[model samples]
Target: MKIKNLSLLVAMMGGAPAIALASGYHFGSQSVSAQGTAFASGAEAADASTIFYNPAGMSRLQGTQFSGGLTFVLPNSDYSDKGSTNYLKRPTGGGDGGSFAPDIVVAPSMYLTHQINDQITAGIGMFVPYGASLDYGGDWVGRYGLTKIDLMTININPSISFKLNDHHSFGFGVSAQYMNAELDKASDAVTGLRMGAAAGAFGPASSAITNLINAGAISGAGTIKIKGNDWGYGFNLGYMYTLDENTRFGIAYRSAISQKLRGSANWDFSGVNMTSAVPGRFRVQSTAG
Candidate 1:
């Protein structure tokens, strides 16, 4: 039942069977919490990702310090819609209208932090800040709307923190970013035109088939392929402050990165069979508040 509604929405979007997303499907799970204590000391004392958060905290640690953990994500995204028709024929085979659905998906991450010095601390963390993927049922009424999508991001960050004084400090890091992106969408069905044509201009639908008839409005069906990936480098800078023994604050800014992905999208049909060679850059920015 829901799938039908999904298909309808996809159809409205001028696509195949479903619609899912905010740009590419990659929304790296590298949530703000990982920076955990880096943003708020109150939160940091509880976890280890702090190695990546505010490694400088090591300066405050006594002996050896180590921290590591992983994050798992499950996203629920889908579509639903109604069917379009001309004559009021009770839908044959008492069944539902239409639908579009996405499978459950998960993305993971891990990081470690160990205090190395009293004033200068160092740590390493591997994480995916952005990642997500989705697929539509192939048999959907609007299969040509959106078929598939995938995107991923991985960051290997090694950082160091310095304690300038009891009240404030500074930290810096060299970041290596890896990115992968995929976008796939289908052409229009023009099913409306074909159905309308079959209903009108004369013949019964059963007979319409024999006549090899349908509205000419359905110019044609097309397909598109969009996929790309790129790798780049950047940096993260942070400042930490101790308001008191129980409270502290941290601010960090990650530089922007430009990922160049290369791919192609083509349209197939009668007179206008065309192909478009596609390539573009995906930019990313990180901010902590």
Candidate 2:
């Protein structure tokens, strides 16, 4: 779907105008059969894909059944400058970020169900529930705020359903989810140099560093990249009630999964070659969250 005029507002300190851009990252359509009605048909329990929407529907399958498909996601992120400014309150330089969203994303889904008996069914499903990928390059005006980001997750669900009578069915499932993320942003080079000087790391070359910065030998820009991955656990429950053969009612709940990522933060200055003068000065730091 094409999202338009959706703005992501970032509060600017000191009254500077904020930068706005389109920002939505959840992909909810996991079943192709349910998509035409925007998933309102989930309660219909028509196929094995129900292992994802309402597992109780698995009881409706007569025998071993399988369903699989892919969903293509194409997103566009067009940025327009709204008087954006840097932390120094100077006009944020560089072009308005171009279309940074990936041209296409393939989300895959698969489900398998087997009727265990007259009243029980077992199933398993795999799907992507959340994802995002974008890259504004290195020279955009909003680089400091966020230059690039890529996040992806996969969920595996093993479920069981019980048909209690002509009208009642219940389902339960547990999930094991995996998530990975990477982010990039510009950091202030001048601030880093000042920190080094203040800590006396520059020693006798402190004044020389200031002169280089003042003479434009340094562009006062750096880049920081963060990467991480983790696994989380959750569960889902559903209940379906068949009212006559033509009518049905259903309710479902999914638990929230929390992930703590262990990763690293890598950064380096872009303009000047300071590594030769201060070997190993720019270092990668370990991080966790």
Candidate 3:
């Protein structure tokens, strides 16, 4: 499909917004212990969280081990309108868009690893590596652009590692990731009314439609909600080498996953239901690395 069409489809299907507080909607606090050192311990492999950072390090973990933690993200952001206009070139008047997002978000993660033998290890991990949430007041001036959005993902990784020797090790894993997303937004009432008026100039029935808009019976401030979820699979590989007793280097590669999401988009315009009488199903395929 053309890039424009695909972009439109994605936007209608609840794609992530362009502006976000985090790094590309990713919550990087996967390990509490690693946070102190700025996650520079990829090669340290001191905890079970290594199952996620680098599975090859699991071979260094003693017996069965488990690590669990929670990272609370308190994000502070707001939108300020510096003169805005609608599609009809009319000033969009509403209180300055205040707090366009939630005040706080909590993310949790867990991992388990077991040493199977002198040269082998097995591990499993559950975490959320990507997500975002934004909610703007319904009456905000920019409501037409967006009102609310929520996106979440959960990844389950199962992996195995082989200690090739005292200084080198290799690991491989498969991932099952589940993603859910929801989007809500308002349709531009003024723009819709202007279009209806233009159409009315050509036909009688169209004139009636325009009259309804002018009469406030069709205010044009419709709302659209889209919901979707999907599951995708991917793989990861890792290698670790011991440079000395206190220094080691690790490298890891994760493959991308393609997912086809299926869901329904519902529209409600002043109590008028649009999807109730039609097939509201929507499908979109996207890739995540």
Question: What lDDT does the true structure give each of the candidates?
Answer: 0.50, 0.73, 0.71
Q: Which residue pairs collide in model 2, if any?
A: none
User: TM-score winner among the candidates?
Assistant: 2
**Which model, 1 or 3, shows the larger lDDT?**
3
- What digit string (tens of lDDT, one per residue) describes model 2 on residues 1-289? 1112211110110112223343546767777788878887866888888887788888788999988888888876698888876545667688877998888988898999999999999999999987888888888888877888888899999999999998999999999999988878776555456445545555787777667656656454656677788999999998999988889888888899999876765654433244344432333333434
TM-score of each: 0.58, 0.82, 0.80
Candidate 3 per-residue lDDT, tens place, 1-289, comes to 1112334322422322222223226778788789878887645799998888888999899999998898777777867888777665677677655776677777889999999999999999999987888877778877766678888989999999999999999999999999888777765533554464564532554565556545555433556666778999999999999878788889998889887666765554453222332223334433321
Model 2 scores worst on lDDT over the 10 consecutive residues at: 6-15
Model 3 pairs whose backbones collide: none
Ranking, lDDT, top scorer first: 2, 3, 1
Off by over 4 Å in 1: 1-47, 55-58, 61-65, 82-103, 188-222, 264-289
Residue 54 in candidate 1, Cα distance off native in Å = 4.0
Better of 1 and 2 by TM-score: 2
